[model samples]
Target: MQSKDLLQLAEQFGSPLYVYDAEKIKSQYNRLTKAFSKVEKLRINYAMKALSNVAILELLRDMGSGLDTVSIQEVLLGLHAGYSPEKIFYTPNGVSLEEIEEVNAMGVQINIDNLSILEQFGAKHPNVPVCIRINPHVMAGGNTNISVGHIDSKFGISIHQLPHLVRIVENTKMNIVGIHMHTGSDILDIEVFLYAAEILFDAARNFKNLEFLDFGSGFKVPYKKDDIETDIEELGKKLSKRFNAFCTEYGKELTLIFEPGKFLVSEAGQFLVKVNVIKQTTSTVFAGIDSGFNHLIRPMLYGSQHHIENISNPKGKERFYSVVGYICETDTFANNRRIPEIKEGDILSFRNAGAYCYSMASNYNSRYKPAEVLWLEGQGHLIRAHETFEDLIKNQISLPLPAKV
Candidate 1:
């Protein structure tokens, strides 16, 4: 999709809208799959936490993608999107064992990261297969905020506790079907990631009946011009060879799996919001937009930079403007960002918004959530409607109070 297409979407769907390109998503999926085509069995479980829109899920499902869900609701969402229970992998953290059991009852694949729940579930249901998410204690991601494999991160079971993990599995007679690790997002060093893979491989040696090894995805996507991205092709070549060798040593061919969220969808997303005001402060010139961190919090939360373009006037002379949001709080999307001159009411498109942007949005300050459009086959399809007042207060009830204590 082009800047003109995004402008058209903003006109049709209104400002502060989300538009995802179906063709971009397709090419990304195809590219990742082709990179690993040499593997006998490969599985790409689209991480639903990134962008859980039903339309997006359905699109990935149609592409023969499985789902990597962190919550029971997401597992159910996968089912709703035409995925079978077996195709869904539930990898929740810090949740009660009851919730995990509930997901398992639906026949979804179970992935446990903590010892307490692993032992609890194993003892209760020894026959049910489980995957263990291990912390290799290797930081492969770009930012510390997004990196999860460090020693202090609360994401996975520590590699040092393998003996204890094995003991629990042995005593419970649990069926161990898979081993997994996720160092973090935006992987920078392929060698560092590969080092973590070796750790996962070592961890896998403890389980003999493993069905697959999930090297959790943190592949980086370019957010701005000339920004570096993960080389999936090179990583695939090296990792595929290692995986095949491991399979030969283990006497079986195990499925290679990646739970990629951003890699598959980040570039496909574009956020369009109209310039609401041009506030000239003592020190800064603010180009305030109709949306805020409530709509896209990555900038404030993780210092993520989404390439902003003045789509309304792409050829206008460039100028530096601090892009601010409408939220009451200090929701600054960009600080002194240089772009084509932005005028009031001009539509600005934020690139690399497909993943983690819309999924993390909230009704903060009670501003209604915006609509979402799917750009497919050169046509814009409304996937989600802009929220109304009814939607904002749908779950709330007012009570007449003249208190009786």
Candidate 2:
């Protein structure tokens, strides 16, 4: 999809909208599958936490990809999107044992991330097959906020505690079928990932009934032009060799799985926000957009950079402008950024907006969330409609003025 396509989507759906290129998603999926085509069995579980719209989910489902869910609701979404229970895996973190039991009852694959819940679930359901999420203590990913497999990150079971995990499994005779690790999102270092995979392989040694080893994906995607990206070809060549060697050592060729969120969809999204006003302050020129942090918070929340292009005037003279939002508080998407000259009502498209942008949006400042569109097979389809005032009060309860107290 080009800038013109995004501009057309904005014009049809209005600004402060999310437009996803379905073709990009298919190409990415094909890329990963083709890269690792030599493996005996490779599974790509599309992480639903990144982009959970039903249309996107359905699009992925049609691609023959599995679902990697982090919550019960996401599992339901996957199911609602036409994925079978066997194709969905739940890997929630910091959740209660009761929740785990509830999800397990749904017959989906269970991935336990903590020791307490692992032991609890093992004790309760010894016959059930489960996956353990091991923390490799590998420092990787783009930012601290996203990195999960570090020594200090509270995401997976630390590798040092493997003995306890083994004992718990042995004591309960629980079926340990998989070993998993997620070093975090926005991972650029390929060696660090291989190092983490080694840890996962070591952990799989104790599980005699293992079926797969999930090396959770955080393959970095380029945000701006000339930016570095994860070398998937190199990674596939190295990791596949090691994985095949491990399978040989383990006496069986188990499935290789990955739960990739951003890597699959980050490049497929474009966020379009309308320019509300062009203010000329004393020190800088501010291009205030009609949206705010509520719509896209990565810039302020994680210092993530989104390539902003003034599609309205792509060839116009360039100028440095501070792009601000209309939210009541201070929300700056970009400060002192060089872009083509912007005018009032010009639509600005934020590239690489597919992953966590809309999933993390909010209704803060009493504003509505933007609509979402999916462009599939050269056709535009409205995935979600723009929020309405009635939607804001859909769940609200009206009290009779507290009985005139």
Question: Best lDDT goes to which candidate?
Answer: 1
Q: List, residue by residue over 1-405, the lDDT tens digit for candidate 1.
A: 888888778888897899999999999999999999999999999999999999999999999999999998999889998999988999999999999999999999999999999999999999999999999999667778899999999998999999999999999999999999999999978999889999999999899999999999999999999999999999999999999999999999999999999998999999999999899989888999999999999999999999999988999998889999988899999999899998899999999999999999999999999899999999999999999999999999999989898
lDDT of 2 by residue, 109-202 (tens): 9999899998888988999989999999999989999998999998999999999999999999999899999998888889889988888888
Each model's C-alpha lDDT?
A: 0.93, 0.92
The pairs that clash in candidate 1 are none
TM-score of 2: 0.98
lDDT of 1 at 150: 95
Clashes of each: 0, 0
Least accurate 10 contiguous residues by lDDT in model 2: 396-405
